[model samples]
Target chain A: MSATRRIRFTLNGQAAAAEIGTHETLVEVLRDRFALFGARESCSQGLCGCCTVLVDGHAVSGCLFLAAAADGVKIQTIEGLASGERLDPVQEAFLECGAFQCGFCTPGFILMTRQLLDENPAPSEDEIRHYLSGNLCRCGAYPEIIEAVKLASHKVKSRTPGGAAP
Target chain B: MTPFDLVEPPSLGEALKLLEPDDSAVRPLAGGTALMLLMKSGFFRPKRLVSLRAAGERLARIRIEPNGELRIGAMVRLAALEWAPEVRRDFPVIGHTLRTLANVRVRNVATLGGHLAHADPHSDLPPVLIALGACLVLAGPRGERAVPVEGFATGHYETVCKGDELIVEATIPPLGRRRAAYAKCTTRSADDWPALGIAVAWDDDGAIRSPRIVLGAATERPTRLKAAEALIAGRTLDGALLTRAGEAAAEEADVVADARGSVSYKKQLVKVYVARALRAAGAGPAAP
Candidate 1:
């Protein structure tokens, strides 16, 4: 075993710290230390996006990223997307569209959608499919997920002046 | 898991010191995408990992020099390059390849240097870099040296990069009037490495110049087809010429079987994609 190193970063709007092994991935750090169970570890490799999280406001795979590499960076899991009493528009859409079945892949999908909206507020069906390709839905809820993303895009657009239509 | 010490070098100099000849056990760690996967599979067992993220020298930046050459930092993320105005304007083919690399999430994390160093025959960057006639700047304990992209990778995951050296940047000469395109054959729209990829570029004079062709995932290392290039050089491209060049490329590439596709299937795809890329490059600029 190797000596653990100190890792410091902002987690879900709070300053967080952990002593992580060099080999420990961010997914392990989130699930094991910080207890952010929302970031699932389905594939453990990068193939499955179950461990996806937002780093510096961009979606990235937590499984392949070293915990130590995130030092001083801002990280957000699915748990961070919502306010104390309100759901993010993406979460609301997912719920309305029944975009998830097993719910294991929902967190990653939500985070990915958040990134998509950040970059392109109003994406077409093809654009949504292209952006969300990293997040796999083993339960085959893709059509519903696409619908949910469209719904969320509309919801987001209504709030912004001159936003692209759904 | 085999134990290894982790060293986070604060600067390139310190990283090079850690990677000195005496410490053959030290390996510079970049994005950790391929290295981590190889480690998980027990393919490599380095005693120490010198993290390059903090070294300041490994991050992304694109600047046009006084001579008009574009200097790209090796550590630049694929996603950043995809949106860079300079790259999109001058090298749209590179931008296209970046947009199609794996997926958005991977693009956000995979660095150019990491991708190049990984030297996976199936990777998208090698062939593109070769076509651009890019030069790699490497820093090591012995100091810095430059190597052309064409001769950079020796075989498989192997590279001319010494264990103590780190690829700092890649410099690309301006493409004044050359047209270029990259095409890949993959089963899915996302998250799939190309079974075969081809990048083609030609100079402005209506005559073929710098006819670079690289076939990925078809050999242990990305192989350049000089014979095919010779066949196309100084000649105007057409369907017949493209077919002959594709045939020559297929013959030059050492396609092999992997979990993704069969050897014959990959070779066929290489020929097809090469022809397609050539045709696309020959099509010239789009209407404004």
Candidate 2:
């Protein structure tokens, strides 16, 4: 097999390109190649959300996503969530709520909630629960995780200029 | 995962040209959610992984035709369909199914055509699409052809699609005045693959129409409960009729035992879910 594929995509808002093999997944390239270690790789099947990342503003399982297929797409990892000295609202809420114990699943949950709140700023309790159902917290931190999302929603809503877009 | 050459043909025509009708080694990558999983498990090792991203916008649109039909491009993401105003307005069941089918992460990347092509009997979309009278459009080096959703899947992880052919889009007919409902019973979480699923569509008067019932995830294929359909074809749905139809559905499906449940258990679940789906579709008041 020839590793002749070169993919050009936007990573954390910057143009990036990498030589990839057809078998290489997004998680491998992100953690192994670029050293973006935030997106955890566990249960490589799409089942576990540990490897979740934002591809063009939508959350996707990095382990199940082919880096070669992501050519020309925008990718956001947990490493990109914080800006210099400030944490993203989702990250702040997660920490504030103590949403992680072991924290292996924290990055995936944070990213999922970020996208969730972005899409629906004022999601109801059921909506929040339903949206985060895929991102499992093995530490049994679901109650706090749910709380974090609720708090993050309020934080996001207040920060929006007119609170029009979620 | 075994390594393979990544081929990106800029246009649909170029992609088709690269695909040969008899070459099973050339696999087209859609959202890569399902395909990637199989590759990770070492189940699928392709000689060439054809990335359709180069096809770009040509295969990524969702169009509501003037004739009241909904035309969805193959590459349209599941999340896009879940939020599409036209899809939500016309076929709300699809939106309902999408919400619980998989997690937000999977939906955001999983494509419509890839979902169908994966052809998993336990999928949430197949039965609903079959009940909605949808058709899948396939384009190949030879030519283009359309297959009704009901006849698309030939078996588990299989379809009528030729190796050279790629699913272009799927067209669902207008819902018109018919009300539809989908009921999926999972062994574990609500998001898990259904142990048994029932999708029922009927007219305003509760009379069964051209398009009818389909039981999914409980059988090898999207099994149309024709015996149950015949039981209520011309009758206005009532509690008794739905109960009777449910029984017919259980008898019609060729259920097999699995981790989800035993064969007999699934049959029983099918009966109950079918009745529940019928009632949800406004099959009159429930029997006392």
- What's each prediction's TM-score? 0.94, 0.95
Question: Which residue runs does candidate 2 get wrong by more than 4 Å?
Answer: A163-166, B283-288
Taking the tens digit of each residue's C-alpha lDDT, what string does model 1 give over A50-108? 99999999788898888878999999999999998799989999999999999999999
lDDT of 1 by residue, B1-288 (tens): 356788887888987887755665568888787787777777777788887778884455887778667788877888888889988887778888887788777888888888998888889988888887889999877788999988898888789998778899888887777777888877654668877788888785767887788776667777778889999998988889989998988887778888768878777887788899999988868312
Q: Candidate 1 clashing pairs?
A: B121-B217
- How far is B210's C-alpha from truth in model 2 (Å)? 3.5
Alpha-carbon RMSD of each model: 2.3, 3.0
> What's the lDDT for candidate 2?
0.85
Q: List the residue pairs that clash in candidate 2.
A: none
Worst 10 residues of 2 chain B by lDDT: B279-288
Q: What is the DockQ of each candidate?
A: 0.61, 0.73
